[model samples]
Target: MDVSKDTPQAPATAAVPDDTPPEVSRRLRLITLVATFGGLLFGYDTGVINGALPYMTDDLGLTPVTEGMVTSSLLLGAALGAVTGGRLSDARGRRRTILTLAVLFFVGALGCTLAPTTAVMVVARFVLGLAVGGASVTVPVYLAEVSPAERRGALVTRNELMIVTGQLLAFTSNAIIAQVGGESGGVWRWMLVVATLPAVVLWFGMLVMPESPRWLASQSRFNDALEVLRQVRSRQRAEAELSEVSALAVKDEQEKLGGWQDIRSTPWVRRLMFVGFGIAVVQQITGVNTIMYYGTQILTDAGFAADSALTANIANGVISVLATFVGIWLLGRVKRRPMLMAGQAGTTVALLLIGVFSLVLPSGDGRAYAVLAMTVTFLAFQQGAISPVTWLMLSEIFPMRMRGFGMGVAAVVLWLTNFVIGLVFPSLVSGIGISSTFFLFVVAGVFSLTFVKLYVPETKGRTLESLEAELRARFS
Candidate 1:
């Protein structure tokens, strides 16, 4: 029952029939488009709050602490969702889990749209966070599973693209809505309801999509796995790939590499989880979400008028989308560890400049623009290198049987870290000032860079099965 775990000296490779049929390729593209709606939802739900919060604050009568609660509640919910969604996907099915999350997205959006008070909004945002956390773990894993190893990076990264794209859409929508409503009492409600359309789309689209072949194989449904593979892969390639996938699935079955028992009792798995935890921390510690959730405030604090800040914030969303596009291209051309380290270095430098500008410059347009420039630069590295690699590696590195479970646990760390930062960032800015707050992120970036060098493994140019085998051997 011992699977052929790939060793460093002898990594496995397949010389399969490379000609994926045109129809099959189209089907794969379609599947990717449909599944990534979860990601779009993730982006919109999280990003909308950045713009909506200003209006929401006034309407909901929020204090600074209550504002933090309103913002971090979804993140807290996301922390719960990461573990809950991962386990649910592992036990029930990724497709089913996403379906359930879609319903939550719709309900959560409706709740937020109609919320009469801060408490109701907090609860609604928490519900929405569940879907965000679920999609963060599930969509990439699902995309990675269905994609060809050769095209895995590009295809799976499409979800990352959609995420930023959704953010850009939110920013644009928020700006437009604000202008149209012109300081209306409930402009944020319009922002919250936009997410419901995508949620409905995700539910309907996933209904017809094929389940992950890897998931089917893990369940001992070899015939079903092969059938699903055949729909997306050429007949010869499907047969060849299924043999390797099924053998690994059987080996995993023998070892029961599916849950907390294996993660606790198996040394290799425990190490992998540790590395997974590091990866999760590395992504969050970059403080990328800080900009995403509060770019408007950051700009305003730097000296922009409130209305000016909201409009300028769209620039952050635009750059995020552009940076992610660059990240996807680099994933195909570069190794993961180097890209991640490079990203950390870039972000660290950007944070330093932001802090320096805020600390030294007078309250003028010059300093405001300087800080805005650095924030955009920070996102260039964050989205382009760290964010894509974090999600892609988490999706790639786990044993097939516990892919969802392992990634889920790691994502819990990610979401919880996000929750803490989201909750504290407002207070930090208020108490310590913008200059010192960014200095803290600069310090975190250094540690994150060191962790990547020492612990993170490269995952490019390898199939998930082969990578899993290689990781198992390395850890063991």
Candidate 2:
């Protein structure tokens, strides 16, 4: 598809001309960087366990089933956190909600680092999961609402980039720290401790950041929202943007705003939620976490030594970060629906190949390398194509008034699906073996592709209000 090049001009305000001064752009970038620390924490907390788990199990004396529970409990907490956070952000405000989550992240990290038993670790991890879940829903929505439409895709996707980068940091740090503290009795505690640094940064950074202008408008705080827009937007543009957002907010209030009842009462919203749920489900069913949370174990199962597996897993983290960069670039240049479908296609083929390689390749040097190559290829497609687009679309598709709640509901499905996959993956691998587990992902990928091709709407180029009207008209 030919990409559109229309950069959204700043809304006309009294303090600036039609063209924004360079200082404004610089400030906006700074805001994006600070807010995205939430994503970094999200990634590190989820991925840190990949390396920490083996040591944790040894220290805590966990069984296989309990190990799965330990890994997935955080995900389950995330599922609840996503929905709760989304709703609270809508009712409260994005900045406040994130500030709250930052505290949770810090407390959760501390709890995990200090836990003395498996049961305590599970509870502590679940607390961390709440922050992760909240961040996944709140950060993207916060970024999208604050960003200019022209740079929206890139800016919103910056969070995804950071998320993968955080995961890479986790993996790299785990490797170095494990090697350095290898002889220490509580070595994994150090792995869990590393997350606290980002959490602290997120909290301090957000304290000075402005609240989402759109969110402010939703609460009828036009003056406060305008002040926020002025910080990152040119004065003229900020006033114009606030006016536009305010008009929509008024219309939404007049229409009685959002709830489950609102969704059920409105056919178009119900349909959009369904699409969102499908998008979330499809993203998870690819079995990405199987590789993420269990990549080291999978490598060991494929014949690599434990140390070799740890070293090799860094490749997975690196490729994920790189692929996310590609994905963010692609988001700016491609239609959302087609990009999603293409991602599904790429992941399907990669999963099929992974299954085939495991089934057909002989064990030893060639098999391990081949499987690793296919795993990297799968990450390239999955992270680059499917993952970023999924998050971006969820953040983009909802109406201003319902943005938080709608995205939250969709994210709830996403987190729950992730939870189920994370919970069952170890068992699945043990029960069905490697080849069949991947084959299962291949089947799910095909179904996901079909869902995107047939049902997912194209959402590029349109403003959030325009998209909502378009979807309402189409579905109505």
Best by lDDT: 1
Q: Write the per-residue lDDT of candidate 1 for residues 1-476, one digit (tens) a residue.
A: 22223235333334676687899989999999999999899999889989999999899999999999998999999988988998888888889999999999999999999999999999999999998898898899999999888788889989999999999899999999999998878989998899999999999999999999999989989899899999898888889888889989989989988889888899999988999999999999888899989889999989999888888888888999999999999998988888888999999999999999999999979988998999999999999998998999999989998999899999999999999999999999999998999999999999988888878877777778888877787779
Error in Å for residue 316 of model 2 = 0.9
List, residue by residue over 1-476, the lDDT tens digit for candidate 2: 11122224223223234477798888899889999999999999999999999998888998889899889989998998999999999999999999999999999999999999989999999999999999999999999988876678889989999988988998899889889988578899999998999888989999989899889898999999988888777777777777777887898899776789889898878888998999899989998888889888888877788778888999999999999999888888987777787778888888898788888988877878888888898889888988888898999878788898999999899999999899888888889988999999888988888788778877776656656666676666
TM-score of decoy 2: 0.95
lDDT of each: 0.90, 0.86
User: Which residue segments of model 1 deviate by more than 4 Å?
Assistant: 1-14
After superposition, the stretches of candidate 2 with alpha carbons farther than 4 Å from their true spots are 1-18
For residue 69, what is the lDDT in candidate 1? 95
Per-candidate TM-score against the hidden true structure: 0.97, 0.95
Q: What range of 10 consecutive residues in model 1 has the weakest lDDT sum?
A: 1-10
Q: Which ten residues in a row have the lowest lDDT in candidate 2?
A: 1-10
